[model samples]
Target chain A: MNHRIGWLIAGLVLALAGASQFLLNDYYQRVLSVIAINIILAVSLNLTNGISGDFSLGHAAFMAIGAYTSAVLTLPVRMKAIVLPDLPVWLGQLEVPFVFALVLGALLAALIAALVGTPVLRLRGHYLSVATLGLMVIVQVVALNWQPVTRGARGINGLPPFTTPLWAYGAMLLTVGIIWRVVHSPLGRAMIAVREDELGAACRGVRVFRTRLAAFIIGAAFASIAGGLWAHLITAITPASFSFLLTFNVVAMVVIGGMGSISGSVAGAVLLTLLPELLRRVETSLALGGQPLYGLSQVVIALLMLGVMIFRPGGLFGREELPAVLARFQRRRSAQRQAPHPSPSS
Target chain B: MFTPTYLAQQLINALNLGSLYALVAIGLTMVYGILRLINFAHGDMMTLGAYLALAGISALVLPAWAALVLPMLVIALVGVLIERLAYRPLRGAPEVAMLITSLAVSSLIQNGATMLLTAQPRPLRVPSALTQRIAFGDLSIAVMDLGIIALAAVLMVALGVFVKRTTIGIAMRACSENLRAAQLMGVDVNRVIVVAFAISAGLAGAAGVLWSSKFGLVDPFMGFVPGLKAFVAAVIGGIGSIPGAMLGGYLLGFAEVFFVAFAPPELSGYRDAFVFALLLIVLLVRPAGLLGRGEVNRA
Candidate 1:
């Protein structure tokens, strides 16, 4: 009936879902973990694209930073001591627990945000997009070339696979809750005001630059956590995985899931991630041959984008908050039923 | 290999790459000047143009000379169709919508290429006249590379004259400055924008052909790098300024070659990253770009 009740319901559903994940086979459980990881990424990115009203292509840079940092920190020191005996135990034996590693990763990513945001925050539109995109490219390039640190283009393999469905989904819920709270907070409202019209917001005493930076840092931190989970889940990391195409996929999810809606972000992350997997299965079953069904995924994504842009420019749930959109619509339908038009005395 | 001849070869390499970027950036500036949209799909359109040209070469075995002329015509028409469909609907929407729409269109085209033709890279064969190289003292050069620079230069001058000396170009310029006032004076804003995309795309197609010719490979993803480089060039040159894009393209080309020459091999993949960093620096120093006009808010 109210926000409290709605949130309670969402929490219950998530808890039940997390419990059920343990019952799943490794393959199906991994899929759930993937979905959870994407949920964090999609929702965090939305804070910038949807709320801060900035389109950042460089999120992968933050994701990479988090993933690599966590992988390096969480790996066993005794193992590295044997392999590279000269290196310090601190660098090698990151024997911290998984959650601590995630937080450390997020902190390091946020520090990077503070450093880069100075120059990057100045740009708007294409300039900003290009700069952020450049950041991503630069990160990938560094990851590939920074051989001593990143193991070069061969990628940093042997990451601990601690990313169970429980951890992944729990992090998603926690991260989403934090972001959703921020989105409705005073700071979030200020960010929205700035987005609606920077000049007007400035006139009204909004610190546009500061608010934007705050949003950027927070979003980066959350994305970092997601990236850490992803690195652990796969047990390997590659620069190629964080390419522009990957950024585009995240952006498409945000756009498709109704950019401004938290529920839409979850829906989008789940649906698009599953859609391709489903399609691949079907194609496999049908024994489709030739080029491995090249570009089918992109085509589906493109068509869906076209349809959403043309027919539902506001996205599936529009700019409306999810709880508001779904709950309000349901309430209206129920109200209509209860008040069903006066039947003539029968 | 590290002799004068080697230096000359690298210079030529840079020039060829830079020339294609300049041509595409020049087209980008025209559309940006006329309508502030960055035309994200411009690069993908170049990919489509290359594909179209490949079809031409495969079907009729057009001489390289004929291809240089023919692909431009076909791509110009395709460009006009893109304007009519995707851009026309969003003329009055926010800049973000148009930008996003261009991205959508680009994805559609890229995937459509995959669906229509195999996603595999193909070698487009050209006539013998185009591939022939001439000896220039210590350095030899591909005729196609020289042709690309020459054609791009000629088109630049032609475009400059069109924007400055022609009534339609003047109308287009006027509309870009103040759409409402230009409409009051009877400028067909829609037609001018459509024309801008068409001409911009035509130049992009010609550049695409040269790009494919020089690289010896063409694929769906080929457009991504060049498109981004040209966008960098546009930003470097000043997004809304034609001469600015040309200058930026040359500088970018020269910079990439020299950066590769000086930097360690491992850092070479960062050529674009270097340009992007410059873009960031340039934006910080001059947000409007080197050639761009000061921000003028619409009344």
Candidate 2:
């Protein structure tokens, strides 16, 4: 709740991530890293979609930009020439450190978001959603068709696996911290005001468009970083990997976690990420007759999403942080204890 | 390549594609007109229709006409059931909730189909008579293409008459204009919604059959691309206007077919990109679309 405790928790998470390098198996470590990356994505998307009330279905497009950019940058120069001969001469000769490549990728994604958001943010509701979806498809088409730079669907592969649990968790922490700071800032209030009522926010001098553009750009940057981490972790990159399905998964996380709730995003990311793995195990071990339930996880997740939307549309945590929820629970428990037998009728 | 015959052949191709898009887009516009919901699962409905037709023909050994009719009827029922189960509960909820619910429904249908029927593409066989070519000088056209165009035209006219002359159709028009006022005027909102879903799903089913027949394949995910294009068409024609959807569909079909036919061979792969880019341009220039009246923020 306080800065001290927040710093302490952040440090503890990093420590666990470090310990996982030695203590956990490669598979578990990879899963942990993926969880961190998903947290980054879900939380960043929350900034635009939840806090700002802009429903963008193009988060994966930003992620794709980041992944492709970082993958192109961090490949060994010799490998780059072999895999991407059509890349510009300077790009083919250049290779950057993983962190720099990640930052550069994020920057590029943010820049594009700023450009696209200017025209797109004008649309409202489903129109905005469809416009973003269009952006996503356009990105995919370019990635698939740009043979010289993107290898024309072959995708640049055999990249250095630069993503580790440490880097992923660190980026995850940074993303959450930045979003938290934004949510508590004046700019954050302006975003919420704009989301609640655009006309009223304008009347109150919120600069509605600027506030939304800011969130859009910020969300895009983090999504790009998440993409960079994902590409490096997978050690392969393809346009197909960044399809609308990925966006759907992230949206599922944000929705199940609670829109506008940072901690909720984190919780949702962990649950949904692990749910598939758990389901995969269940699917393999348990089957109807002789058939394995290959796509059972997707069915269950979709059903869960539907159930959540119908029953608890606010998601698991609603708009409150974990600490606030726990505090509320504590207060309720003590009050119940104090009034155990006070009165039945009153 | 730029000869009149070549141009005429391309025009026929455009008409074929446009008819398919218009059929799908009409369903989308009709649903949007009444409920203001985008119905993301409509595409999956097409997928289901295609699959159902496949089952009817291949498994049930039904005649071609019977196969087509059965799927339309089944999908219409499925559409009504989906509305009752998934959408009806979230009626007064925020628009986003319904949108997300539709996405969930889409996922359910897609994955459910994948689980039941393998993800592999299945061949959909059309009757030989339908696939036969009808030659007009150098411009040869498939009988299937003619059938699609004719069927689409007939359906559109039938739908036009239904909407204009039928009591339920009038009620639908009233509901689209003002759902609350229609309800206040003693119109059955539930029946109107159900009818909208049924008609949309039935048309989507027909489009799905034509799509599978023309392409000679049926797959669980086959409807996604066409469905998305049809959605773009719906937006272009004004989301809630049936005639607007039809015009948008034809324009998009021409744009796509022409862009692919005329663009450099190297740029042909960017056809989907071109379509989406057009969508962005349209949204920026005319957010309400060509036939759309006023701003789109009804909520």
| Best model per DockQ | 2
Listing candidates in order, what is each one's chain A TM-score? 0.90, 0.96
lDDT of 2: 0.88
Which CAPRI quality tier does the interface of model 1 achieve?
A: acceptable
Return the TM-score for each candidate structure.
Answer: 0.92, 0.97
Question: Fraction of reference contacts reproduced per prediction?
Answer: 0.43, 0.65
Q: How many collisions per candidate?
A: 2, 0
DockQ of each: 0.45, 0.62
Candidate 2 on A1-346: residue-level lDDT in tens? Answer: 5999999999999999999999999999999999999999999999987999988888889999999999988899889877888889988999999899889999999998887787678766566677677778889889999888888688878989888999999999999999999999999999999888998998988888789989999999999999999999999888888877788889999999999899999999999999999889887777666667667888898999999988998999999999899999997777778888645542
Which has the greatest lDDT? 2
Worst 10 residues of 2 chain B by lDDT: B290-299
Q: List the residue pairs that clash in candidate 1.
A: A77-A93, B237-B244
How well is each residue in A1-346 modelled by candidate 1, as lDDT tens digits? 6768757866885786678666778888888888888899989988888888877666788889889888777877765565434445467645788889889999998887776676667555545566777778778878877665677677777777898887887888888889989998999999899788888987889888788888888999998999899999998898887876667778788889987787888888998889888887654454345435556777788778867776777777777876678688897777778778634531
